[model samples]
Target chain A: MGTGFLDAFAQEYKQLLDSELRLLVERLDAPSIIKESMIYSLEAGGKRIRPLLLFATLDAFGIDPKNGLPAAAAIEMIHTYSLIHDDLPSMDNDDLRRGKPTNHKVFGDAVAILAGDALLTYSFEVISTLPNEFASADTKLKLVIEMARAAGTEGMVGGQVADMEGEGKKLSLEELDYIHIHKTGKLLKFCVVAGAIMAEASQSQLDHLSAFAHHLGLAFQIQDDILDLTGNQQVIGKPVGSDTANDKSTYPQLLSLEGARAALSNQINQAKEFLKKTGLNTNLLREITDLVASRDH
Target chain B: MGTGFLDAFAQEYKQLLDSELRLLVERLDAPSIIKESMIYSLEAGGKRIRPLLLFATLDAFGIDPKNGLPAAAAIEMIHTYSLIHDDLPSMDNDDLRRGKPTNHKVFGDAVAILAGDALLTYSFEVISTLPNEFASADTKLKLVIEMARAAGTEGMVGGQVADMEGEGKKLSLEELDYIHIHKTGKLLKFCVVAGAIMAEASQSQLDHLSAFAHHLGLAFQIQDDILDLTGNQQVIGKPVGSDTANDKSTYPQLLSLEGARAALSNQINQAKEFLKKTGLNTNLLREITDLVASRDH
Candidate 1:
């Protein structure tokens, strides 16, 4: 029912966020080399899913998607910084991300690390200074708190550490869920919560949206696990089955391949139900959920 | 006139901040390893100059020093995070800091990196959520803005990059000043600004305190450069003359050792002049200025 609208909204907002990311980095009164390093990664191609979810959520509330630009860019920066650090030789040691050389590979590790640090710090500054017309001071403060919690230890960082610790060992299904939920899932959930906060959604509406985000986040990660084995190398941009190659636990590892697919479908369906309960025009969000379920990368 | 007062004030608040640092890390619901890594560096024992400045600024304004605890901790977290990242093998490659192993040395590179990221992210969160008794929402938002600007690319990170780019080159006094002002100077300035913000000082008072802070920051760095050649290794907790050994440009390298000492004394006197203009009980601030001018480490 919403395929065309989702496509149009996604295309329009994706371009808007891309330019915003570039402009934001360029606007920093920093050394040119660091700015250039930051921009190189910011301009690296990704699906921009977090920003899409944020824009889609605002769309659901009938708010102007432009209102989400600062936040969308901030979240993307956080995500990109994580990826940069994750690809360091001490971490995952990957040379390529999305078919391009990693930040460390291009800038050398020192500048790359500083660039990542700069992006992470700059994000809070961006969110805290959102224009008065777009958000109240209280709203901005709350957003900062939420973003920090989601991206900090109790959420993404904690999850990443758990995932690292869990490597080279067989993990229970519960353990696998724990790692994905904190590591990848929290930031994705933040995209939704950030939208709801900006929209000033009621308590009940916020709860429904939060539940929808939780399910959607799980579905997104499970789909990623599925695609690791099934996605085309050309489409996914990295080697297929790299997760298996690393002996990492995945949904398809803990649950059989068929079982992982069933879990993904269940999560998607439940996410839709929560969206329905929000009693808002959630067509864009629903379509985004569908896309997450089926995306190759 | 303020000798005993300065000693007592510094002693009392440094202990308060030291405990607060430990408590803050313990309160985080993160993996023990990352928390330990973060705490390891946080406890690695610097003079707590930033927090002390903040507390002293509050004291000047007749504000309760306890009110500045959150902001003080937040600034310390940012400082500690920078050290952890800066000491990485790809960066300074320092194995020892303050006579103890660096975070990367103890925690491994990957965890040390993540721990730094976590501390940096958590700092904004800490400031944004300052309790109602400590700061208003508007004040918290402004603090976040100022902190980010001071710590992010426009400030510390920018300075670090410039410093890195200037390494092994013959830097002019202006170029060296540029690196120190942004890299180290900005964060120190933040401590004073943060204190003024919390104390709700008038614009004129804030301006005077900021000027004082600028001179103090420069004085602090110049003394650091001087001490690099002449400090006792036991008291400084690192080998003396390390900066000269690295061929990193220092005030002594550019201005000569005597010229660097002259610069330090000049900055301290200028800092005291600014403090006098503030028309507050700035004895603590004044004494701190003197300490910076003469400190061997």
Candidate 2:
């Protein structure tokens, strides 16, 4: 299952994301330092989970994944921008992300920050550039609105603010939930919803997909928290226990390791249940679920 | 005439920008340090040129100034993000902006970068959230698209990349023009176009407005370059000659001071001619042109 699923998924979806990213980055005029900085981080290796979920969600609806490629790429751009800014000296102050010096460390802080800004704004341009493909104008507009919301104040940014403030202080479980939901869950939900929007999924399908994404996101964050405590830095490609060093509130800090583990299991189960209602090719989704639950890092 | 125009412009537009900014900042969820950092830089005193253009453009079209408030505020948000990121230690490394410690200095780099990111994303959210009074969904979407273009790789960011690359190097006049047009002209053009969009102007009116904005933007940037060389630090609220210190290419660097003055005069004249074709209220626009040409800083 791992080989088959990974092979098929990587073959199709990863290629689509890579092609889209290449096209997008190639559009940046050649040899401009900030553009180079943007391209470097954007092409940096990651699992492409967000873009894959977007493609998979479209596939589940029997829509051609190609139809959602722009949106998929756009979301990835937004995600990359978030990661770039998150690693800035003023933020996470990290030297490495994905086994390379962080964008700021490599490109200088100004260029890194501007590149992230450029990427974030370009995501919208990518979405807007979709040429009458998949979904009505209304749907496309709504997708843009949703993407903005997910990436903006009420979603990831809001959660980041909460996370930054909640550091070095204990947070109630509810507040922690709020932070995670906005920070991670919102964009994850956008991946699903944006995919559904591209596919023109029924409202019912959207609702289920949203729930699925929410649960999956919770599980994903919990797993990350757990991995930060237990995973090797070489494996994770980032320093472990940095969260602890920052005194950041995490699932483990709030729920204890066992409790966090249980929460992850519960969320994974809920995600699986939600996926079941979609009645689509659930193999990859299910595998990802199991992967989320058991992954060491 | 100069004093009265400045006073009236300040009274009418500054108040609106201030109120809109306050309301926008107040909408952030409380107790978030990142949000506070965002608000700090956003509220820090500056000339508010972008928002002024937005408002003035709307007024020129006889649209209620209040109707353009959201877009005005959103433009300012984008501008604020640029300033915050530009002042980062890795970027321009400026400790001060607008006579205050830069956002990174005041809030730390991490929170400041995040705050800038948040504000950049939030600008779109604010645009998306504009009440229905602004225009139809299609028009709003167009505004979003225009803004995305201006802020993204093809516009402001592209120009920034070129500017960064051109540092300490002699650039041709054409290259300097391209850099300034992208870095400053694009957003300034967006401010005007956004107002015209909100007012639902005719295609011909939009054409004229576009022309007006394009030249006005060039004029504005030229004036900025001149001010950097000749203006007082106290009046300009930033260190004069920093551009020269950084060996950054500018219009004046490519053109002799006399040549730079000629270009500014030509652009302002073109801007006035474009406004003449529009047949809109020319009072504010005329004063703006004059102010751009004559300002010491």
Candidate 3:
């Protein structure tokens, strides 16, 4: 439960995730602009938290986590795509992401849009093409189907629509939860489930991991809401108050800053509880929960 | 085969495909706007050519064509998503499609974009979840991989970029070929290959189907270019000369109208010849080729 250990575990996955992503792009043999735009957003460097989640969960099962490398990279691609599309002028329209130019800002909206589209397609391709020896075709197909569902209309994209339509409206906590769960929760949950499935964990273990991820995802969003309201723009990599500026609702607005903080803590503790119930050596997962709970940026 | 026979064959698949698409959207249990936008595009009625190609190819092999319904619908969704994105303001900026307002014009840019994303993701979900009786997990995985390749940057999106960048430039036939092959050809080719794979065709059969599809796709594009120049706007569901209006290079623009016409005929013939090589009962596929070569609209 030390920063030293958490940093080391996370650092390993980040390097693997980053190198794999770059190689994935390099091997595409696509036109220069499309590849450049994709690589730019991917290599821009986020926290690599999603991959860390997948790797950590796989690690807890004592599986050779590298076997899940493609799937982890695929999840990151999906995350990167959501970010690119979310930053489009028609959507969040931010000029900066990760302290660099957003995809559309540098590549133009058309290329940026296509770049996101390409990555989305590539994600499925990556997972589907993983070696069938360790990862059976059935397992890969399940991963692809689950990832698609999470990323599809009733999940991420649907949540996006709900979020957009809710702009300028005061949303009830229930409505906000719907958006938060679908928007970010589904994919985070997928990261945890992906690890379990790849490790061929039992259904009981999967249920536990899924519950752990659900709370982790909610905590992640609540913390995001808190940071948007109170954190430093330099550290957070974007201006605070964007939600308020966009006339959208957030946990801090609906639940109050103190209420949001309490909710975050509750969710983090719940996540840890679920992890503990799995009866697996999840020390790394526990540290991640702690990192998510108390991180400043 | 008689036109009556072709129409009946096509009519059966269209109804099945249309109903399945509607049911799929209905079952998504998504928010209203996303559902509304997706159904609007899915039901807009664009000949369902991709699905028809899939069904026709599946039929030729004596495989139960209905078994491929999910995949056929998936292909159509990918095609629809491309059209939705292609017509975006930053892209072709078309206001009309199939004699109706474009998705963006109907639902606003954000919903249209997300609608497209939803459909793209849903396509894979549908294919991956196909009944185990119809397709082995290995077959499903291959379908997912090929679809991704066809839809990703190196295929459709890459073709679109090459197209957008090629605008207003004087392009040779070789350059035009590259764009058409990737943009329209890749997906079309996938339809053929998908059916073959589902039927577990031999390698020689696959090669023949691939070749057939390549010619059919090129012929399809040439005919589209011709229609852009000479067809009625109302019949074609958009203004004639939109391609030229956008300053895009086309077969007719680079090869003279007569030369383009001849090329179209040649390709259609080649497609038919390849089908003959497959030694499958491909009467329906041949008819589809003729439809491609001679369709005025």
lDDT, candidate 3, at B55: 88
TM-score-superior candidate, 1 or 2: 1
lDDT of 1 by residue, A1-297 (tens): 447878887888888898999999988878899999999999895888899899889988999989999999999999989999999999999899877899999999999999899999999999998989989998899899999999999999999999999999999998888888899899999999999999999999999999999999999999998999999989888789999999899999889999999999999999999999999999889999988987867
What lDDT tens digits, residue by residue, belong to model 3 across residues B224-255? Answer: 99999999887887789988887888899888
Candidate 1 to truth, TM: 0.98
Tens digits of lDDT, candidate 1, B1-297 = 446888888888888888988988899987789999988998887788999999999989899988898889999999999999999999999998877889998899999999999999989988988888889999999999999999989999999999999988999999899898999999999999999998888999899999999989999899998888989988887888888788899998888889998898899888998899999998788888878877767
lDDT of 1: 0.91
Candidate 1: where is the Cα deviation over 4 Å? none
Docking class of 1: high
Sort candidate 2 into its docking category.
Answer: medium
Name the best candidate (by TM-score): 1
**Residue clash pairs of candidate 1:** none
How big is the RMSD of model 3? 1.4
Q: In angstroms, give how far residue A113 of model 2 lies from its true place.
A: 1.8
Taking candidate 3, what TM-score does its chain B reach relative to the real chain B? Answer: 0.97
TM-score of each: 0.98, 0.92, 0.98
For model 3, chain A alone compared with the true chain A gives a TM-score of: 0.97
Flag regions of model 3 displaced more than 4 Å: none
In terms of TM-score, which candidate is stronger, 1 or 3?
1
Candidate 2 TM-score, true structure as reference: 0.92
Shift in Å, residue B20, candidate 2: 1.6
User: In model 3 chain A, where is the ten-residue run with the lowest total lDDT?
Assistant: A1-10
